[model samples]
Target chain A: MRVLGVDPGLTRCGLGVIDAPAARTLTLIDVSVATSSADADAPDRLLAIADAIDAAILKHRPDAVAVERVFAQHNVRTVMGTGQVSGLVMVAARRAGLPVVLYTPSEVKAAVTGSGRADKAQVAYMVAKLLGLDEPPKPADAADALAIAITHALKGGGRTAASGASATPAQQRWVEAERAARRRN
Target chain B: MRVLGVDPGLTRCGLGVIDAPAARTLTLIDVSVATSSADADAPDRLLAIADAIDAAILKHRPDAVAVERVFAQHNVRTVMGTGQVSGLVMVAARRAGLPVVLYTPSEVKAAVTGSGRADKAQVAYMVAKLLGLDEPPKPADAADALAIAITHALKGGGRTAASGASATPAQQRWVEAERAARRRN
Candidate 1:
């Protein structure tokens, strides 16, 4: 299954696409960011984001779309922007006939790193190893988007058992992924 | 000029259309609410809202769109939903080549009822009086939407001085509107 993951934001939204053939295999298909200037009007910025996501959906034709859920934060303006982008992406995904799922930051971290409290560096490192990339994806947002996609592909695709340190191949993949993350860190 | 006012929400977004021939003259063209079920998936709910707003824009073809600017609140989920709807309406309005403006709740209240701290009843009463309607619009959401349109027409349409009690004809309109509100209360 090909999954598109979106880390929604107004200034810089991250997009990542990955194909998972089996529980133990993952391949990175594409990664990019959608950006809008802060000086532009709110409507124009929103349109720029919507158009970029629409293009990504058309280009990748992912089987499923996963979006990072916006959480309550101190900055109301930032939270508002995040929520708006999330809504736009979700609607666009549904319009394209793709099922949409939302994952919280902890959910993504637990799924990918076997710990809900994993830091950004650890998550990015795991993402690189999981996708067999030479280096971690840059700009943190791109790595986050890829992590969300990997989490959904592993969990939603119904190919992996519940996560743990057990010797199951899924667990083993995570262990290796974690080890790679440690090495890179 | 025709103005479309949107009170944004995820479950029930209120829409109001009004014709502003002059700063003092206004007519209500339409008032309604767009609803979505909480049981529906997020994407589907978002789509329902988008579709409803899109249809309103196509049907009304307003010259300007006014959306209630989302404010910080304790309810994160509610704020997120409201922000999403606001973004969708603004983008759709721009796509239709209409100018979009955002009014704070206090601004709408002051414009309609002569007090930024006016309660819902006061705003509703003024909305009914301003539109010369025999009865107040049902469903507070619809009434708020109408109030928003009236505020934009009174302010953005260049009828009133900057929100004060000077006895311009615009101020006179406010005095009458406020008197009407007090009578209803």
Candidate 2:
């Protein structure tokens, strides 16, 4: 199964693709996206984000999309930012006929690094190591995007043990694939 | 001008305080509210979030808070998560002494990154680089939180910017301290 992980933004939205095989190993495919404008009023900007999401869907052809869900942001303005990106991503996925799996920051952290309170550097480091990469992924956002995908791959009904630290080889392959894709991006 | 940004989450919430001094330099301070089953019931969770917001206000104190206005996500369950988080955060701000500054995601991206189509990472990177941070803040969620505060600093005036980035840091310190003293658990 192929999974696409996305980190949406206006200037640089990150996309990571991974092929999840049955052995728990992730087959890294590719990761890339544009950083446009994420302003609320710019319909053109929203279109760009939609286009980016569609492009990823068409290129990766992932069966599922693992997106980071936004909790309430203390600022209404910031939450609006979360909602706008989320809305565009959701629309693009729906249009592409892919299901979206939402993951909380903590859940993704725990799934990838065994700690919910893990920092971005830790999450990035774990993502690289999990995929057998020599260095942590750059553009930290992309690494996170990949982690979201890996976490879902581990949690999706295809898992062996269904919890932290027990992914099968196929699951492992999917995670590895995500890291490989990051470098290519 | 001082702007406060908040990323509200049921489990882990983020808070950021930024002083956009007129001297072309920025001072940024951020924090997080870590909760784990601390709220026994739905209401309790709401209150916990509210209290967290209050705590943020007391700690970072800003003339205005830029929050992302809440939107109903695709799934009802997800929408509930967004709404509850927003409600508590907003309530806390009102209960404190600050006026709320709301913006849509696109607006924030446009205001911060000069585009409405940017993703969270793009925004965060620009936010960090623009504010002079060597690296982007962790957990996209916290980055979003910082975005909210920066939004207020940039917009010029919604409620108080009319008073200036209300441009001094002393007022910010006072408001933050008051909120801290009145903190409720």
For each candidate in the order shown, give its overall lDDT on alpha carbons.
0.83, 0.65
Q: Mind listing the fnat for each candidate?
A: 0.55, 0.01
Quality class of the docking in candidate 1, CAPRI style: acceptable
All candidates: DockQ: 0.30, 0.02
Q: Candidate 2: misplaced stretches above 4 Å?
A: A38-41, A74-76, A157-185, B1-185
- lDDT (tens digit, per residue) of candidate 2 on A46-143: 44665677788887788877777665533444554454565456545655655565677898999999999999999989888777778877787789
Q: Which regions in candidate 1 have their CA more than 4 angstroms from the true location? A: A73-77, A158-185, B157-185
Predicted candidate 1 versus true structure: per-residue lDDT over A1-185, tens digit per residue = 89899999999999999999885699999999999988776777898998999999999999878889886565675888888999999888878987777888999999999999999999999999999999999989899999999998777442221221013344357656766777999
The clash numbers for all candidates, in the given order, read 0, 70
Best by TM-score: 1
- Minimum summed lDDT over a 10-residue window in model 2 chain B is located at B159-168
